[model samples]
Target: MGDWLSYAPSDFLLFSARTYYRLFELYNRAIWPAQILALLLGLVILWRLHRGGARQGLVVAAILSGGWLWTAWCYLLGHYDTINWAARYFAIGFVIEALLLIWTGVVRNRLSFQPYRDWTSRTGMGLVLFALVVQPFTGPLVGRDWRQAEIFGVTPDPTVLATLGVHLTVDKRPPWGLMIIPLIWCVLSGATLWTMGSPDAWVMPVVALGALGLAVYRLSSARGQSGIRHSEDS
Candidate 1:
């Protein structure tokens, strides 16, 4: 048991930091102007979040669905899986998440988008800004080349981050199921980046913890509200 425990996350890595970042460089070049569209999508999401209605909610869900699908195919399977064997499974997870979003927000029309005015909502908007405007430059600020930057629509990391932000920002009683995959991905991403010794390694895990706390608090409040209503009716 002790022998098995001795292995650190770095010991499991199959590629060098340079090789990993190079994949981003190549991916960025191949994708070209998609990054511009991705940023525009982020701007649109931010703008529409305030004027949220059912239609706007569906739009948000559809955009995220497309982003996940794009990352699943373009970055995960096409790029990262070649280096890491587990990335194919990650791609599967991304696809499932996309479909889930479609099922919940599009097909079922279950998501109710609202402009929540609270601390969670405020924090969520900050996350949205981080994912859209800040995340792309994070690698570059840490001394990596601009070519290696990850964009919201083009890569899994920022897409996942944006999803987290959206989940927190819109729903007064956020969907616990929808939050689950993003939280899991957060832990996985943080571990992978930490293993690679990236300076921004702390971001994902911290996001996960914050989201989880918010989820619990929101759910408890929801249940308490229901119980109060039930008592009053009785």
Candidate 2:
């Protein structure tokens, strides 16, 4: 049993790099124009955030909720699980995330966005842009076919990355519960990509960690401001 514990994560992988990329190719082809629509929806979310209204925020939440649900059903459960049984568990997590997004961002309507002004907000916007625009180039730039490209709103990695970015741009303290899955997923997906010998293996972990650091910074700043306000009141 101790010997089994020494096994690397790569040893447990059920699919090859070729299989993983091919899965994405097939998934993309099967989905067709949905990708384009998703991209448009992402742009709309960005516009809403820039405009800054509660109705706009609700729309963003609804769009994000739909994205999570779609990824859970179409990618994880419907496709990835066929090759990797573990993906079924991921599908569940995705679904839970979808529900939480709806509950917190839509039903309760707590989420709000602001124009990027601070270093963190600007950085967050950059991450969001990377996920939406630059991320798909990783495959082709690394010598893989464009067919294997993963886009934000389509694939899990970029989706989570973009979500983290959007969270960082929130006008108030970022949603911690909303971030938990994406943070875990970033590490897990980064490890998986690393084990697969992917050229873009570092992106996921770097984005995740960077977002987390910023989130912590924002949280501390909020707390400090609250303390100051309390002291003044007293």
Candidate 3:
């Protein structure tokens, strides 16, 4: 463990025969900073939403806070192994926050879908898919010399590929189940956009963007519908 800590970021970044070892070392350091920042940013976002009277923000805040707190606790205990394990779980916070923000902020607000959200979702999906599916097939694709790469910059190592493939394939069982929330959000967004003028205005950058846009439109329309209902009730 001490020896692993001695590796430099450059060692992980560069693609060499021993890159896998260096990558493992670098990932340990990298995740801490990223997790910390994500946690802080998520909190700030939640605070803003709460102040703005967004009830759903509470759920986002809770998830992010829990992940951040657990990560911090693991770090303080000097449980590097646990910290590493927690880091992966902490990533769920990132995904959840991103999804919520896209669904609530842009979609609900009827704002145009931006490239940032599309890219993030696509990249995340790709990584998840790679982790779950492509990774497991590595041993069959390559030889037994497969070792996983820990850092992002290096080429796919055998272990890394196998692990990712396996994780993606196993985790995404019943694809419809995994996709239900996003699908509903998309339907709502689309309905809202259709009610508004120009349903076909923007070209979707990706399928995800299209889904997100439709979801947002739906949310905005729901707000409108709710306001009308309140007026009639009053």
Candidate 4:
């Protein structure tokens, strides 16, 4: 198996290719324990969330499954960028899972799980906010040093423009684009929990806690409006 810890942002293009090849090699040998583990973990979360009456679990399952499927397709098509983009999408599966767990188990008390939902939610939101507001300006901090000229190599006129727009919008560039990193982080953590043992599972629990905080804030706002409505009715 390839060393997941050795991956760097600059190697994303080659990494996607090599990772896909490795995954395919594993598939051919019928040694897909890791992939199966991830799939099963996703399914288990979906099942628990569904059983607990959390509607978000369905969306989470779709995102997780769809993202993985898309990544596989991108790999088959030799679209390295698409594969890299899908990696970010896959990362969000963790946050969605955390959200479902919190809604069903923590807030609703449907399961005998730890109470980390609020922290998890907050961490997810904070990371997302940081990615949106800070990551882009500090893109060089993460080592993605591709020059703008090199980025647009050999692409035609309109295609070049569209590609440039996507790059500027989604790449580790400034503005709201930086949020992709945090989004990716959430997914990565989720995948880690799914495939590897969850010794560091507290990281995701913290994220769930953060999300709970956001949910509380939303509920409080709703209650405030209800109070005003009651006042008017009186």
Better candidate by lDDT, 1 or 4:
1
State the lDDT of candidate 1 residue by residue for 1-234, as single tens digits.
999899987888999889999999999999999999988998888877877765887888888899999999999999999899999999999999999999998898777655467777777878888999999989989999998999997798899988988888766688778888889999998988999999999989998898889767767887998999999999
**Candidate 3 per-residue lDDT over residues 51-154, each given as its tens digit:** 43343334433433333344333331233233234434433433453354345433553211111233333343344334334533443343322232221111
Q: Model 3, residue 42: displacement in angstroms?
A: 1.7
Q: Pick the candidate with the highest TM-score.
A: 2
Pairing residues by index, what is the TM-score of model 3? 0.21
Compared with the true structure, what per-residue lDDT tens digits does model 4 show for residues 173-192?
A: 11122123333444454444
**Cα RMSDs of all predictions?**
1.8, 1.7, 18.1, 16.7
TM-score of each: 0.93, 0.94, 0.21, 0.26
Clashes of each: 0, 0, 23, 21
- When summed lDDT is taken over every stretch of 10 residues in candidate 3, the lowest stretch is 150-159
**Ordered list by TM-score, greatest first:** 2, 1, 4, 3
lDDT of 4: 0.34
Task: Name the regions of candidate 1 deviating beyond 4 angstroms.
Answer: 1-8, 232-234
Candidate 2 regions exceeding 4 Å error are 1-8
Q: How accurate is candidate 1 locally (lDDT)?
A: 0.87
